[model samples]
Target: MNTNRPIRRALVSVYDKDGIEVLAEAFKRQGTEVVSTGSTARRLGELGVKVTEVEKVTGFPESLGGRVKTLDPHIHAGILADMTNPDQAKELKRLGIKPFDMVVVNLYPFADTVRSGAGESDVIEKIDIGGPSMIRAAAKNSASVAVITDPEDYQLAAQRVDSGEGFTLDERRCLAAKAFARTASYDATITEWTSKHWAKPGTINVPPVNADESNDATNAAKTTAPADNPQFPPTFTRTWERAHTLRYGENPHQQACLYADGLDRDGFAHAEQLNGKPMSYNNYVDADAAWRAVWDFAPQIAVAVCKHNNPCGLAIGETVAEAHLKAHACDPMSAYGGVIAANSTVTLEMAQNVRPIFTEVIVAPDYEPEALELLKTKKKNLRILRVANRPHTRTQFRQIDGGVLVQSIDRIDAEGDDSANWQLVSGDPADRATLKDLAFAWRAIRCVKSNAILLAHDQATVGIGMGQVNRVDSCHLAVERANTLADGENRAKGSVAASDAFFPFADGAEALIDAGVKAIVQPGGSIRDQEVIDAAQTHGTTMYLTHTRHFFH
Candidate 1:
């Protein structure tokens, strides 16, 4: 690769002209001719820079209302012609086509226009076709051309031309990579928008192809699948932009960064930090856990305290202050240096109650003025975030070793009013008073890791045991935590229990019953579900089958 190639002729066409004049001045100083399109040329000429219009260079006027401006042999050949090949150079000279050594371009703002409530047809018109074409042509011929897509890169281009030298091969290749990514992201945004608007539900009228009639069974199978089971019309594509770099990853030694699909996204990704030092990686993890746990009970004054991505305490109350106090009493030891989230605005009384605790972060939909001032006075370094209370995405995603795993979010109605799948296959159905706490425990347990158990009394968490190796162990841990809180007087007595999954055997049910759990809620899918129900009956305890598993891991 040639390390240094002088940029003698430059073409500058862009929708954003923030730094175009400075670039034009640098090109003029280097004796490089500047060629541009309609508005770009007019703007540059007005800035007192000499410019050549695209019509003069290409010998064709801009047509189709500016859509067919740069898609010409003259423009593409100038960008793609091989300067090193003698035969190619001779052909270019015979045709009187001058080679372009540099291209500076920025595409139309399709994403911004779509976001700004523009009409569909208006947004569609803003998608730039010729700009990406020129960018790709210049990038493909990076050996002889330099491509610049961002205004931030103007300084790099100016510095090289001003140094009496040209761009190195490495610099050109780097810029080419960026140009390709820009085009790809732009196309993906357009695809997403079109799919959302045009792709609708309809049955495929075509009959399924018969596999037995074809000699090649594999081909027949592929052909019949789409007709038999139609899916969404467009292919799925993901796009993300970098948010910022984190201080570190899960540990201080590892590096990490955050990225989001959009900047206006709510929740932890776009939370407003009102008062605090910068949040760490662990703070983000815990804060997200706490936030989602609280959102499960939104429109209610609910509170969730989390540690290590597991909820340590959860409670629902009529007032924010009462919820904070009750949630803190669930497991005071585990709540140390934990993250807390509230469903409604944090009141001043709630802030004062939790201010004495050594909490890492506090998050809510909003905060009262007095509450915000009190919290800032209490701890200068505590992270306080206010989310905009938006609806969460329907899908959840996680990264694996080689690929990603995505699934529909567990938006089960824990209260059982919206679901017809719930069953009461046990000694007896939970009464109205107990069912409220059962629903509370069910929602809270879903945010914990697998093999999870939670015991609640009067809509407040008494104990939570999560991430155990076995269901029986989780039951024991929950019982132990409750007993410790009650000073060995059996606080689990008459409390409702919820599990993330079904019990494999009757021992877990018997254990919970012996520990004074009066009622239970589980998914009820194991083969020994009858035995577990028998155990519950034998211990004189009631049980309800939700028929829905809410496993987090």
Candidate 2:
């Protein structure tokens, strides 16, 4: 088998014409025969490169509104023929079809068309049929043909052509692998879009069971209604393109890289980094946590300080600067070297306060010019990111031992913030200010890890304890931090506390009450609910039950 083959004949067809002129010039310089379809041929001709239209080789005009241009037998036979085989070479000669040494093709912009909100018919027309066929055929015959699917590879291909070396066996194989991945990702995108927009939910057709062997089990299985069709499709395919290779992973010993969903969406994954070194794995993790935490209070000036994928401080205020100050004051020691995120734009005032702190990353929707200038000058090593403020309602994925666990995002619903929905189970009714603080604490608590406790006053966290083995320990830790970290007076005094889950006993509530907490909010579903309520009433502490637990384990 020949390890190196010269590119004497080539087939090129692409929707994206970027860098096509350079490749055409290289083909002209190397005296390589080129055949392209329709607009591609026109483009190459306009670039002063001689080209043969695909129809001239196939002896068939493009039909079906150009959909049937490259689907002919001549085009594919040339791509798939094994020239090393004498029988195949003789057959190709008899058919008057020349074999292709190189195939350059890129598929239609189906994903982009779908994302543009085009009509069904318009999107369907954008789905290319002949392109993938040619790509796969050439890729399968990589020993003889080099397939190019991305325009980014045009420069490399042009250089190889200019060098007169064509492509080596290893180079062809690598290109083949990339070609297959491109097709797979394209098909997965089409499948996902069709399942969500076109497919209808219906009962699965089950095979008939023998009457003699039929039982209740078989009958039940035959009629079981499946989950929603779009959400849980018959086949699930996820594809992400590599975005960056980080310096290291969570630690220096672990290797890691970042992948993007290949969509024009808003989130930390697609955020633009304006300053600082490349983000590390842990930096992305903590920055994402903080970004999500602050967005929970959207349309308001909210700030979150996160460390190790857990929020140490979160607060909402009238301005971004005030919010940052209050959130930072929650636990300055914990906020040191933490990631910060703001729901609103970062202002000059906010940057001034952040300049003194040692923050690993700061992400927000936007940044004022003065603020950005200050941060870029004062903190050259800090990762400053700008992400668009958009609703993030996508599903979440977590890898397990052998598979992945998928669930919808645990978004704070409207009921979670409406004080009227909360049940006043113990003590006097909370006033307006106390109810506001309770709502803020409840929303902020979801950002903490399981067995979490958060104390808030004036819509800013004063204390937070998370990742404890028991609720009692978390309660004690929160109170301790509140009082010990107070700037002047006890921060826990007249503060509202939020628990992620129900307390098994009354000791947790007793600890908070003893720390001067005036109100407590939790999902009341414990077996000893009366005991817990009695403890709160005995201490004259206002308590509200949300009936919804936000366990974040």
Candidate 3:
């Protein structure tokens, strides 16, 4: 690679004008001429930089409503010529095309255009055929050219070009990878739009093309089997960027990376490291996992304390600061180094109460200026981020072996009326505390996997036993653990119970009654609802029936 040859001429086209003037001046200082088209040339001229208009090279006016300006071989040949190939070198010289030593181009705002509610006709017209074409050409001839994409990368590119290195081989390779990723993301967006909106459902699913598990099959070159079938099939094309690097995996030796979707407009993807240090791998995974569990509630203040991806303590409070104090108090020993996410703005008082703890991460929608300043001073490396609520239209996504799994927002847990649809044969109308406990239990049950049991006290979950095989056993686990986790409060004693699904027999409710639970809440749709209600009434417990069943798995 000729790293020392000065850039004689460069093709420049971009949607973003940021830092372009500084770059143009640097290129001119290095004796490299800047050639651009349309708004780019005009913007450069306005900034007092010497820029050659596209008409000078293409010998054509900026015509057809500015659409046919830069799509010329005179421009592309300058970008795409191979200095290594004798034929390519000779043709470029014979055609009077100066090989473009650099290409500074960024595509049109295709992603943002769609996001702004533009129609397909309007959005499709904004796709830049020339910008990406120029980028690919420069990237393909990286042996003698430089490609710059992000405005953030302009400084590095300027530094390299001034230092007379013309971008090291490694930097060139990295730019090529980024360029391909940009184009691929554009293509994927188009594919998803075509498949979901333009074509009917089930149009893309076909039988497996190859019974292979290699990386090539993972790519979308061939259509595979139908989703949900037993045969391994690569489905949706995942587009995610690294969220952060963790200290380690669940075990120390394992490696992990946190990734956000390509089109993440807000929330965790845009979480800013305000004052403190970088986040660890576990901190990110646990913090986000806890945030997901808590964002289901309303905009009110809720505190979720997570230890190793499980909730050691969770509480909803009157204020963000109060929630922090109460949630931390749930099990201070367990909350020592856990990740805490609040469903509201974190205040200074909350930060003061939590800053002293040896926790790894603290995340919220926004933080008070004083709160961040104080916390940053105390904990020089605590990862504090501002992403208090779920982004608009949040979707839960996961990867399973050969394919991806996506589901609804997971917050839609309640769906029907208890008084009209549920059958109850037991005690009288439940009291206020009983209803609140039922709501708490409902919320807790949705967090648990199917066949789960949740017990609560004072509108706070005391014990949650999830993913059990038998209903009775799950009930027993929740009941037993509540006594220990609840710190002898005895919520089960004269307290309420809520089940995610209806009890098939009287035994499930009986298990709680034996533990001194005085009330019950459930969907109450089972054929044995009479028996369950009889057991509840006989046990002197008021049972409220919410018709909605939250069977999460």
Candidate 3 on 410-522: residue-level lDDT in tens? 56434543333444556776666676666666665665566877766665566666677888888887777777654676655765677878899889899999998877778
User: Which 10 successive residues of model 1 have the least lDDT summed?
Assistant: 225-234
> Which predicted model would earn the best TM-score?
1
- Compared with the true structure, model 1 gives a TM-score of 0.91
Q: Write the per-residue lDDT of candidate 2 for residues 314-349, one digit (tens) a residue.
A: 999899999999999888998999999998999999
Question: Model 1: per-residue lDDT, tens digit, 179-207?
Answer: 99989888877876776677545553555
By lDDT rank, best first, the candidates go 2, 1, 3
- TM-score-sorted candidate list, best first: 1, 2, 3
TM-score against native, each model: 0.91, 0.89, 0.72
Q: Each candidate's root-mean-square deviation in Å?
A: 3.5, 3.7, 6.9
The TM-score that candidate 3 achieves is 0.72
Residue 414 Cα positional deviation in candidate 3, in Å, after optimal superposition: 4.4
| Model 2 local distance difference test score | 0.89
Off by over 4 Å in 1: 63-65, 201-236, 413-421, 485-489
